[model samples]
Target: MAEDNPKSSVMKAGVDDAKWYWLAEGWAPGGHIREVDFDAQMRGIDPLFEGIKIVDCDTHFTEPADLWTSHAPAGMKDKMPHVRRIDGADQWFVGDKHFGSIGGNVIAKDRNKLLGRLAFQNYDQIDPGSYLVAPRLAQMDAMGVWAQICFQNGGVTQVGSLLGLGDEPLAVAITEIYNDACKERMDASGGRINGMGTLPYWDKDLMNQEMRRIADMGLKGITLPDRPERVDSSSAYVGPDGKVSPFWAEVFEICNDQGIPLNYHLNASLDANSAIWDNLGFDQKLPIHALLHHVGCAATLSNFMVSGILDTYPKLKIGLIESGMGWVPFWLEAMEHQLDEFRTRENRGLKLRPKEYFKQHFWVSYWFEDYAPKHMLEEIGVDRVMFETDYPHPTSLYPGVQDKLVETLGQHDYATRKRVLQDNAAELYNLEI
Candidate 1:
């Protein structure tokens, strides 16, 4: 059984993909696209960014249905994730269990904004740029973006469902297919987009081999589960131990040795704030959950700050993707206070305080934020902060990426602006452009 969350809990009726699928009825408060001069924006770079190539650190790449099947080894094709039109929505499935939807794509093929609870419902409705390489490159130029770090939409990398299917060989194959496709996309786009890779997180042997493979293959980074206990199981990863596993630290050491960044895109865990959803209806709860999910990284990252993992692997670079930067200062302050109040730092034998570790080991991306950009960029460390437009996803800084870049970031001095908007990402991802 799949995790029945708001995104994938659509009433299940139909099963099987289509020669072409019909669109599902959209959610309430959806499809309100702002009127913008689409043609002009697409013509060329925005003058405000006349000389800089902005890097959007966080964007979700909608995986094509054939992403795995077409690329699969002849024997493994049927076992990979395939899209089935269920109740009019395109849902991913493996064997019999459900995976997840083609997550929150708010951009329409016709270029209308379909945000908030509103969704495209199927591949027929999304922009080609959201998935295809050529259009993605063109849009990057139009939006004055140099490169983007993309994650898979719905596949093995997605938490829970894919791994819960409980087959290790199938999971490894699924992860490799996505990573291989990312390399192809990177080469095809001339390095304009770098899709982060995922490992078979449930197994240490597979995780070790895959991490090394991606590094040798020149993959920029790999998305890891911040909560390892939930992922590693007796059938694959390990039994009994969860978060406290020494194996987790060993994986970090491999990443550090390979100079591979460890990326933990916001996962569904440790969110003290999501409890507010118990009272609201799905549509009402959706937006708040999206916001809370981003802030939830505060818990994930802060936990690592004291985990002594980074203290062991000091050179390991970690990224908290799609988690906005607004809550960082307050969260760091809160963390430091607890460390001081309880004297945990002295006991932990910490080399530095929580803030120091955050700056040293972690990097974060932001979209649709003002206070952090307007006031807190300095506090967050310009070198550690990067720009993001969740691009195409609801709440992504879509349509107005160029306008917003100029609006929020234009006032800063050129060096600072370039660092936040472009250089930090280039440094983090080893992006050539």
Candidate 2:
């Protein structure tokens, strides 16, 4: 919006709130708020180029405080985290750490001193300004992200971790607040950035109400936990009389009837007690999630397939976000192996291979994991896999993400590259631009 100087243009995203830089104060690695030199970023180091187009499949925004304080029915807000005074503003405190504040753990943590060597710290010379893009076009120019589907912060709106909220009703309220905040953010973006809403996992009545609201608000889709603890309805747990958990049937029906897609985002943890604590051992925090993501997806998907949900609702589409591609081949093989064993039976309503349902009814998004094996394209099917820069997170490839991918899988030819970076996501999200 100014001269060629990227500094003057650093924070202004066409307008005052156009860019939502969650890591501005240094949540991301290699970030030092006091020393951020936008001009230097464009001039000396990695310059923000204008040609690359990135659709950041994963990004984040601080969830609104009112989501818990106002939306939580009755005394439930008291159980959830309350806004604490920090740096002259009320902020949410989870596990006794402040969020949505300039001085919070994620925003201002010492990136260089972590126990596990972080990628951002490793690439310390890179500047945060070089990664700045808030206005859709500016974002496109900054990180080459043509589009971004963002998530919500604060513990309650923090996906599967909602189990910490203690009950279904409060969890539903937290989700409602998250959706409302997302609607406002999407409106502010003027459709340039699509916002993903959180779902009310427990109560069917509330879930349906919010689903309808999300549709009317023009949001792209809703992100819910893979486990049943955070979700209500009949599917909260495995039991014959479990509140008619087929509620997902209703959700699927709504999405199908309304032409909306449902995104299943992995949360911090499946166990509520352990999710809030960060010091649950390196193995607990990182390695466990690594294993659980695949296990969770496989389990839920298998259940959905065998429970006759897919057969009952063939038109519904589900997105498996942030789960890596390595599991694709193994899981597909396992499912088909089972189907091969069962196909000759008469009551088998399913007529296609397990892989067919995946190709037809589901989508998978991959983080820029360097070891994306050579035959990954053949294993996961290039058209169904989308590339994502999990920006600001530990795994994010911001500042130099695309180049990393190019280095990893660039030799695969133009078609493979295009499919991994652009075409796949465009098709998955139904993006016209």
Best by lDDT: 1
Query: For each candidate, what is the lDDT?
Result: 0.73, 0.53
Off by over 4 Å in 1: 1-36, 40-43, 233-244, 271-274, 277-279
Model 1: lDDT to the true structure: 0.73
Model 2 lDDT on a 0 to 1 scale: 0.53
lDDT of 2 by residue, 1-433 (tens): 0122332211111111111212232333333343223232212112222333446666654443444565556766665556665434444554353333322222112222222322222112222321222433353454445677776533445433444434565556656666766666556655546668766654556767887788788777777655544222234423344222565656777777765776776533334334436667533555555557556666666655655556666777777776667778889898888777776223455555678878877777777565553567766787777766654454455435546655656667666766666676665565555
Which digits, one per residue and each the tens of the lDDT, describe model 1 over residues 161-226? 545656767777888888999999988888888998887665667767887788878988888765
Our tally of clashes for model 1 stands at 1
TM-score of each: 0.87, 0.69
Give the Cα error of residue 119 in candidate 1, in Å: 2.1
Clashing pairs in 2: 19-134, 54-144, 54-145, 54-146, 201-231, 201-232, 202-232, 234-244, 234-245, 235-245
